[model samples]
Target: MGQKRSTFLFSALCFGMAFLYIPMLLLIIYSFNYSKIVPVWGGWSLRWYKVLFESEEVWSALTLSLKIAVMNATFATLLGTLAGLALVRFGRFKGRTLFSGMITAPLVMPEVITGLSLLLLFITMAELIGWPGERGITTITIAHITFSMAYVAVIIQSRLAGMAQDLEEAAMDLGSKPIRVLVDITLPLLAPGMVAGWLLAFTLSLDDLVIASFVTGPGANTLPILIYSRIRLGLRPDINALATIIIVVVTIGVIIAGYLMLRQQKQRERDMQMAAQEVVKLDA
Candidate 1:
């Protein structure tokens, strides 16, 4: 009976994995097809990739997306770090609960509503100040930052929660000013969390479609918007090629990050062992 149950579970897991990943694998594989018709695969070739490279629209869209992602990541990390510090380090203040809810409102709210609201606000601002002449890269980046900051704040909050407060408290006790302690101790300890938050923000910005669609104006088509428009017309081989490229790039980044993290872990372990040995010598 146990063997039968195990077999059933294994089959279910395999089916689940296939269901999730098979379409992506097929997309990657079909990227190399010479045929323009998606289903009719005529021998493997990189024809579409070359064409995708030459297409100015794809390049423009990708450039806009990358720019927004980078800007959003940077600003989100800074603002989120401040917000996280306020949430975790600062004692309860007036409207603390309200502030926390406002910070996290983007996380739970529907993207359409978020987009519509921001659009309305932007329109109001433009009328009031005559700034942001048209919704484009700037508007999109701001929209991304609004939501991306929430993810960053969450990551930073979790990190701060798990982190040792001893270093911070000790710094304060040793005549270090609050700002100095924050800069030297807290920020350094929070480096990993900041990096993680930045990456998360970047990914969220890059992947966002609905919010960006509402915020962006003419000439600011993001990669997702471009791909979405094309997919609406019909599946293009170039789109498949683009997806495969993104997959390859992301896979490589993950591998490199993993390797660096492993190296850091090993170095920390060695340092801890050496410090322990030094303590033993002092005791002796």
Candidate 2:
């Protein structure tokens, strides 16, 4: 009976994984197909890849998306880290509940609503101040940052909340100023969380389509937008190639992040062990 149950669980796990990954596997395989039609295996060739490389529009959209993702990741990490610090470290402030709720509102809000709300805000600001001239990359980047930062904040907050505050307290007790303690100790400890948040923000910004579409103007189509526009006609081999490329890039990033996280965990364990030994020696 136990053996049967174990086999059942393993089968279920395999089935779940296959359900999620088989489509991606097929897409990757078909990316190399020489035919314009997808899933229909024509002899494997680099024809679509060659065309993808030559398409100036695709490259432009890709470039724009990369720029926005990079900017959003950096800014979101900064703002989100600060917000997380505020929530975690600053205890019992006035309007703390409201501030926390506002910061996290993006996470729960529908994408369409977030996009429309941002569009409205941008338009209002533009009319009132006569700045930002028109909507385009800047608007899209800002919109992405607005939502992506919330995710980053939640990640950082969870990290901070789970962490022990003894090190921080010790450093402060040693006559270190709060700012110095944060800069020297807190920030170093939060490095993993910050990197995770940045990567999460980057992925969110790159994956965003609805928000980007609402914020982008003429000649500012992101890669997702370009793909959306083209797919309205029909799926091209070039799109398959593009998707394959994205899958490869994302997989690489995930691998790198996992490696870094594992390395950090090992380092942290070593540090704690060393600290324990030092404390034991002091007591002796």
Candidate 3:
């Protein structure tokens, strides 16, 4: 019975992995096809990659997306960190429940609804203030920031909840001002969470389609938007090539980040062991 169960579990894991990765593998393989028609397999060639690199539209969209993602991630992380600090450290301010609900409302909201609401808000703001006269990268970045910050705030809240307050309290007791304690102790401990939050926010902004579509205007296509429009026309080899490039870049980034994290963890473990040995020697 145990052998059968183990075999079943192993099979299930393999199936799940294949289900997720098979499509991507096919896409990467097809990207090299010499044929323009996606379904027809011509001899393997780098033709699409050359076409993709030379396309000014693709490069422009990619550059715009990167700029917006960077801006959105930075703003989201800053705002989210502030909101998380307030929620976790402020100790029951008035309207805390309402504030918390508002911050997290985007997480539960439908993308269509969020997009429509933001569109309306931007239109209204334009009518009243005459600012952002046209919806483009700025509007899209703002929309992305609005939703992305909620995810960052949740991450920060969870990180704060798990962290012990002893160090912060000790800093306070040692004549550190509240600002100093926060800057020196709390923020340092929250660094990992902040980095994770920023990355998450960046990914969210980059991957956004619906919100960006609603908020964007003429000549402001993001990479996803451009890909989506092209796919609607027909599947092109260049789209596959672009996707393969993205997948490769993302995979490389993940591998590098994992390696760095492992190294840091090992160093931390060594430091802990050395501290333990020194304490033992002193006691002896």
Over 4 Å off, model 1: 267-284
**Number of the top-ranking candidate, with lDDT as the measure:** 3
Q: Count the backbone clashes (under 3 Å) in each candidate.
A: 0, 0, 0
Error of 1 at 191 (Å): 0.6
Candidate 3 residue runs with Cα over 4 Å from true position: 277-284
Cα deviation in Å at residue 66, candidate 1? Answer: 0.6
Q: How many backbone clashes does candidate 2 have?
A: 0
Between candidates 1 and 2, name the one with more favorable lDDT. Answer: 1
RMSD list, candidates in order: 2.0, 2.8, 1.5
lDDT digits (tens) for residues 114-215 of candidate 2: 999998998899999986788898999999989999998899999999988989999999999999999989999999899989989998998999999998
Ranking by TM-score: 3, 1, 2
Q: What TM-score does structure 1 among the candidates reach? A: 0.94
Residue pairs with backbone overlap in model 3 = none
Best-fitting candidate, scored by TM-score: 3
lDDT of 3 by residue, 1-284 (tens): 99999999999999999999999999999999999889899999999999999999999999999999999999999999999999998899999999999999999999999999999999999999998899999999999999999999999999998998888899999999999999999999999999999999999999999999999999999999999999999999999999999999999999999999999999999999999999999999
Candidate 3, poorest ten consecutive residues by summed lDDT: 160-169
